[model samples]
Target: MTEFKELYVRKGSVAQDYIDIAQDIYVEINNYFKIIDCNLKFCRMMNKPRTELFGTSILDAIHEKDKIKFQNIIRNALLKKFKDGIIRSDLVDYKSRIIATTMKLNPILDDNNNIVGMFVKFSSFRLRVEDSAVNTIFMSIYNSLTDLYTIYGTDTKIRINHVNTSLLNILGYTRDEMMGRHVADFLVKNKDQEENIKKLFKSLESTGNFTGEVLYQAKNGEEIPIHLSISSLVHNGKVIGSLGIGRDMREQKRLESENKSFELKLQNQSKLAEFGMMLQGVAHNMSTPLTGIKSSAQLQHSRLIKFKDKLAEKYGEDREISDNITDIMKFFELIDQSVSKLSKIIKNMMSKSRDQQSLSKEALNLAYVMNQEIEFLYANQFFKNRVEKNISIQPDLPVIYGLYSDFSQSFVNIIKNGVDAMWDSPVKKMDIVMYYESGAIFVKIKDTGKGIPHDIADKIFDPFFTTKPKFKDAKGEEPNGTGLGLDSVRSLLKPYRAKITFESGPGKGTEFIIAIPVKENQTDLNN
Candidate 1:
């Protein structure tokens, strides 16, 4: 520690001076606006360790009503749009008390002048009451920035009660056109987002605010991405409407997409490489239908030959050949089903080969997705009859949020593994049961086959570890099943706040249990 004066400075003396400014709240946030560090004063204000505050989204610190103002400030600074790179806004500490302050975003730039991180300075602390405080501070700095924030007020029922000039301009709608309209009227609804929005309203009622990102539809039907923070409005000590502050995120999302393109390309390539094995399953499955079709076709042809002779002998020249149409039609049904199965198998495999980055992370009906894959497996008549399947998925199961292909592939791997394990066992049965209770969803998939060996059970999830005989790939080089099925299953469940646990023994079959927090309790996972 060292002493300092206005004229004299020491190496560590100015660091404490920086903390003293703005009541000692200095923070650094990442590209996603998540806190990376804070000054000791800020730590005292937050009442939590630096470790606890790390990675906390900065959105949690800004008052909902002023978030749009804050976004404009940081965004302009990072993009170098502002000449001075300074703006004022409000911050909420851990106690939810608002503090008015001036903020500056010092961009951590790379060689190309692109922002990599942000060094934020907070000063001029005060008690924030309205958005006008921030507007007044920036009014002089940004003369032509009248439409930077889009603001609207929605009633308890979500009907738009008011819209600011910026809101009208951003949405291309007149005040008269939007007033009294439901907020969702301008939203392009995704699967189960309605449920999420309802949850947001509940959050606003309880916590007085909510912050998240969502998509809004412009007047011309273009989908526009937006980050929104909303606070509940009160009248006569009761909730009346919500005040929403939003900033368009189209450019941000586009840049992020551009940056991730190469990484996603590599990931998709790896998945395609892994798919070479699934193609083998497709070929192995085709054999069941092909063999059945061959025998049925041969017997039907022999019957037709005998029928043709009898008809020719009775009539002049087999005039109305109705000697055996019933059996022939049966053979046609078998042929038709076989061809359909073959087509589905090929389509499923080809789809897995393509990049799925464009696939939206929507709420998927787990039962529906699982049933589709089950039908694909049933295409192989040999495997279908050999295993007993009992699926008891609830009728109104809550949707799980994630990519459908991922979870579908996950179940296919487990079921396929169980089928393979039953090759030499007398009792081959698979049971799928699901239920929800106390804000948690439980799934049990039990297989009554030669269970996993007790000695190797712990190693089952290891990649490239398998006990089965190798099946040759298209190139005639056999790979040891790439044993990543269970590993991949665990990865797929993570986004849903779920985990898989298994119980297995040498002769006692295996049961894999999956548990996911109900949607109401779905936090700590990516949206």
Candidate 2:
């Protein structure tokens, strides 16, 4: 057996060793936005030791007005939208003095090019201006305005005169390729955007500046969304050109899309929880009356049998009377069978709805639990009417232990997935088998529906990775394919130390096998 503690290793920080000697104030923040390390220059600038700065939120040092913008910058950087970006902001020093700084953000990526942290360099614009008038413009234009800077000649053609490195990188163009081209050649995204550009120029003519959202076309024809602010550049009290600075909106748009998706999934989950409560309540209310009906059925059954016997004795020679009595008894037997099934279903519902957060674990009969889930699924019209089910359970299986909801919920989710997978198939069938061996109970659920696609097999268990249609209505009661089913199964099985695996392929259908360890000390309820 491998010990849990042995599967780990420690690593040292290589960033500190390399960035410590750099002149600019450098800091590294993990993906969570916590400052993890900082160079000595950063420590001195804040007048705080590295100990006080490390592990703190970088947001603490950013001015309140720029916090949201800074956060979006970090999000976009982590998404690898660009190599590096520069933006201006006010930073709070250790003495709480506000310093205007131009900060550049660089994404630190792992071998797979996935961003793990952010590297930030801060240059105090105030200090940089103290050098000289010539160098101030040079540094501010090259360093401060590095995000998406463009200068257009304000001529009849509105020709581009200069483009910064950042703009070139974003547009995938060189200075030579972009210098003489009309600004509309890159800024026009569509006919609508072209009209918007006319409006922008109108605004600029009246106000000498325009700030709004627009689309910029890259060399490869990808439309890049950006928030742009443009101003008429003046030289000697005369307008010569227009300057444009833009912030990339790709990451912001992506985040909004993800947030919408999450909200839908959350709504679906909420509806499911509500439905569960309603079902549990109905089961609770019907349980007692259903049990009474079953009891009355049994008593009436015994009485009818006795009455038939008495009549047969009195009219032994009458074949008609005897035949009538036999028919009556058969009708009573059908009623009895139905009531018995209903009783079992109600019992299972009550058992499944037992408090899931109970303080103590209970020994659970795995076969019985599976049977209850199947019974509950049958309530679904598709499963009950269209699906053909085969079940085989080994006699006298050992008991597993857990809160009843954990096992019951996991089984239902897996079985429900099987049902949903087969919904569109010509042949809809399910096979379930359970047995015990080597102190573990195993249950297998197989379906004859369309199987999992090969490309997305690994992601099937990932939360919110559904191929289902987007949620459109809140009135729907079912899960609406939230993609949380399997991910939740993975979480629910942890308490039992259970393992679940599956075999699936397109058109061949899917089979899921779950192995749950049976602990000897967990048989209290079973006994």
Choose the strongest candidate by TM-score.
2
Across residues 204-253, which tens digit of lDDT does each residue of candidate 1 receive?
Answer: 66887878776788788778777878877677897666777777887887
- Model 1's alpha-carbon lDDT is 0.68
Instruction: Name the regions of candidate 2 deviating beyond 4 angstroms.
Output: 1-146, 156-159, 187-202, 217-223, 313-319, 353-375, 385-424, 427-527
Candidate 1 — which residues are off by over 4 angstroms? 1-358, 379-382, 453-457, 463-480, 520-527
- TM-score, cand. 2: 0.53
What alpha-carbon RMSD in Å does predicted model 1 have with respect to the real structure? 28.9
Residue 322's lDDT in candidate 1: 58
Tens digits of per-residue lDDT for model 2, 224-312: 99888889889999988888888889888878755765576568556756766787789878877877776777777788778878887
Looking at candidate 1, the ten consecutive residues that score lowest on lDDT are 1-10
